[model samples]
Target chain A: MNIYEIEHNREIVHPNTRMADVIEADYRILPLLYRIGIELGFGEKSISEVCCESGINPNSFLLICNTYLLTDYSPSSELIGSANPSDLIKYLSSSHSYYLNECIRELEGLIDKVASDLPANQRDLITTFYKVYRKELENHFSYEEDIVFPYVRRVIEHKEENEKFTIGTFEKNHSNVDEKINDLKSIVMKYIHSTGNRFESMQLLSTLYILERDLMKHTFIEDHILIPMINLLEQSHDSQ
Target chain B: MTANNKRVLIITPSRIVAEGLITILTQAGGFTIERVISSISRENENLLHTIPADIIIADPSMFGFNILQTLKNRLSEFTTAPLVSLSTMPMSRTIAANFDEHISMFDTAPEIVKKLRNITIVDTSNSEESQDNNIGELTSREKEILVKVASGHSNKQIADQLNLSVHTVITHRKNITHKTGIKTIAGLTVYALLNNLITTPNENL
Candidate 1:
């Protein structure tokens, strides 16, 4: 479940309008919505309680479908455009982690159901794609919650919050990309892609195509929608 | 003490990464961790199956379970799910062991913690008595090797711990591996724990 699936299901009232898509996006409010959900965890609200607090209906299939799509990529500061680290957890969970869980449950069933649809090779390719997708998806989400967002929030809120810090002593937001993503990309090409194994060459290619599509869009949300909101939140919090 | 706090579950294979993670996770205080499983175990498995934590939080490393199946198949029966395999060791065979079972695809730790804490639902019914830390299967020599390994001592260190030559320790390592069918020191420690072979490490992990 990547961004393509969400965008692909757009049921705009008018197919003739360019604005119909983003406007019809069920995901339009996810950035802010997820931000709140993340904060709820830090403060008092359980995530599910927080998601319901905003009335987004986490159990909905469209939301579930969107959740699945958003699971394959990360929410980068560059990617999401700079949210307070505090808001990042919410932004990520609301916008990403929440969706990923939905995808995991859905994909587990889907893969099991579709196990018979493809040959061993195709199934293997699909399985491979799922593995890469889940791993990258989980890893990226963790960065925001455990590292990136927490760093931003600490920077944004500073001593305005607490001394010991609920975020504890960890801060990964200061890390450089050279330390993180590129090497990850290499592994994706290796084991997940089979490094050009004959058994999954064709099927793996298609799997990669779908993954690339979802990852790009997921990156789009994190890079575009969520990060900007964080920047805005940081500004507002600082001004207060 | 810092060594005991290496609580993260990384899944990459690079020594650069293994060294890198040792630097990072050691600073965290919640629990201690290291690669206790194998990386190939993460391939094509359920993302949940690979999680070695009470929860899971990962990234796109499993668009197709590319690393998902391997981890899941191993822990298909596990319910509390304690392995947290990261997808990027380059995630590694050593770091892979730290995870619940496979490699995580995502890049951050906050997100991982949040996800595991909130989303991953442990099926309590499926969890087993593996948590019992009272197995009594090891002999006195095996106990010595077990303690040394659990304390982060290398085989040579264990040999020194018991005043035995490294060769004797190597023999012990083989016997331990053969008797328990566990290769990594981490695995043997875990085996010791499940069978009550030794007292469990402090819950600080």
Candidate 2:
């Protein structure tokens, strides 16, 4: 489920909305909140209730709620301006772990299964492609986790913005992770012929497609939401 | 050229119409006339497989309903490029709606270019995220089918994946269409991409 539906038809972002209902709506939101150290366990209560119970800063809670609830891609001022940088840093770090450990690992197993039965040459080609794509994705994610997130933390702490390594540089130099994945999808879709194992091929393709979709969403959170918020913080720091 | 530059394919048997479009579309220099397929035939369709275009403008006078419909259906299989049919006379909204958008012979160069620019922006961006995400009443099962459909899965393929009959898949698709009010696969695909139901190349970039 996308944020657009929740924002328009359902009112999931109101301060009074129960945290339980929000979690029920999209279980993924749980991990995001958990990253920010907000755990909703056994207490069927509103966001305010949970925030109060956990003694979490109310501003940070609202910032996160708005990020998950708003349909548009634009990050809110509250999220960019007020929320603690440590909170976002922790959230993004956990997301990186999920990608490297869970998503990529699962896809690797599926690829091994699917490519095992193919001819030697075809299998070699597929394996090589997968390895290259895997490396690129890992590099991209780590670049964010190691370089970008820490920079964001420093900026949040009012450290001088890196004169050489601005956010615009990262934006401009963003890797073509999506393009390589797209090539993989095209290769499987257009070139690879099923060797009578239609089910296996379907499974492989479905996994690739889902991985691509998930990665894009992850990148969206980083590029569209996270980067902009950090930039806002940087601007405010510079002016001060 | 960058990916944003419009790559247009003109399919008109009439040299007059094709040249007119070429002149007008290239006047401002943003559009790259990728190819001018003289007519829609088996051969031109094959050519489309190789040269992926951004916009396709076809004059439907020669083929009428059957051929035009066939071309539209065939093009939908491979590319998300907008298939715009050029109409000489006033066309019905239903027919116009079949294609992404229609233009008339009377439309001046500036007007035609304006429509092309509008479509280019829509095609390139996730601006249509709201329209796509308004799937208010679809069940999770139906939503799954919609994702599969947007991913270019045929009904039979989707049925096999879900272990349901093809008929069941078709019914779900129809229900999805009824609820979402988006009938064409291209439209649905755009909606899907916007709502992150599917993935595309460097969409954020």
Candidate 3:
């Protein structure tokens, strides 16, 4: 089976499940764990124990983990109710930092190295394409951070409803920031075959694929977990 | 030196004009002047057909009164290569319309390079889009649906507009997602923009 393929019978991560075992199940969860503020040195601690130590809500942590790990997993209203919006926001903000500061910065460096081995026109094309993608990604994340996140925080904390802005507004404008990366990958694969350093190009492509997958997951969390949770909050506030 | 360098075939009767273009294009970079011919006649007609070129820069004035007929009959084999008018003198609008692009003597090196690059880039990308098999080029019907989807139309709306069943629209959308490897509507919009399915971002959005 493909590593990313959802297995119906695969064990789900529970509060009592060993944190180490979660990583062993799929190493991809390491980034998720890191974004959620769960550090290493769990030392046989259960998920609940780690959450307790980190001052995280165990139920919310499990919801995020199961949602991310299991492709078929959909967060029910109960799951959304159990998740703390502030915790989700913190996790998502950290994920944005990971993508912008760490992931894309690394990609920019790799692409530059790869471009060094290509012809001048191809080099300019690849570099310019990547720069446009990076700008779009930065804009996407900034919209969320500047507009969406702050509004959600205000709604949660002060119960102050902004008639002008809501999660629905976010849902409408939430552009697929990951699609351009897919285009860049295909463009490179199709056109950039005669590069001097094949290894560096391969590294760049692999990093792009990883970033695409991670961005999809991040968007999923925002669409499914974050949106529904905020929608529920909005409905409650409206009824009051 | 690379294959990416666009092959430019200069066809002008004046040696000074041809040499000047060669110097400018060489300085501007990303172009290789493949051949320079002073004039085309029955003896040299075969040379035009034999030489491979991505673009053709020709002086229409050299063809005299019957410029359009001369171009159509003589350069019939080079339908794929964009014929750019290398304007040394003021030309009529009707005569100018025969060529794909125009380059004036007053134009700067960067301006000339920009015009050439625009034509080459669009020409190469169109050819690549058709020839490339790995990306699974979208069919006309699929492209039509992609435009609708990129414009933020729902499956039901697309079905209504295109006079198809909702189920058929859904199936077409699924195939689009599969072929493009893009799931989100925003992603599809960007794809449409990149592929020139939609001319501008705000056109249908």
Model 1: native contacts recovered, as a fraction:
0.00
Write down the RMSD of candidate 3 (Cα, Å): 25.2
Give residue B62's error in model 1 in angstroms.
35
What are the per-residue Cα lDDT tens digits for candidate 2 across B42-120?
3234357666578888776656565567777667645656888787767656567678877889988788888888876
lDDT tens digits by residue: candidate 1, B1-205:
4432323343432445445444444443444443322123111122433334432323223323423543443443333234454455254344344354433435565554444433344445533322322234546766767667765778677767677766556555544543453443434444454345556443211
TM-scores of the candidates are 0.27, 0.49, 0.56
Decreasing DockQ order of the candidates: 3, 2, 1
Candidate no. 1 TM-score? 0.27
Q: Tens-digit lDDT track for model 3 on B1-205?
A: 7888998888776677877888898898888878777655332443465666889998888665453666654564223567899988998888887888999888998899999999877534333222222236677877998999888788899989988877556656655654666655655665676566885554332
In model 1, what is the error at residue A36, expressed in angstroms?
Answer: 6.5
Put down candidate 2 lDDT per residue, A1-240, tens digits, no spaces: 110112212334656777887777776565467655676574768877777677665555665555455432234555456656566667667767876787778777767777777666556556766676678678887888787777777777777545677776776676435545545565565455657667777877787676665455555566655667777877777787
- Give candidate 2's TM-score: 0.49
Per TM-score, the best of the predicted structures is 3
Better of 1 and 3 by DockQ: 3
Model 3, residue A93: C-alpha shift (Å): 0.7
- Candidate 3: list runs displaced more than 4 Å: A1-11, B1-205
Residues forming the 10-long window of minimal summed lDDT in candidate 1 chain A: A1-10
Computed on C-alphas against the true complex, the DockQ of each candidate is 0.01, 0.03, 0.03
> Residues A152-220, candidate 3, lDDT per residue (tens digit)?
999888567557988989977875677677766765554466457788788888988888777777877
Candidate 3: chain B TM-score equals 0.59
Chain B TM per candidate, please? Answer: 0.33, 0.60, 0.59
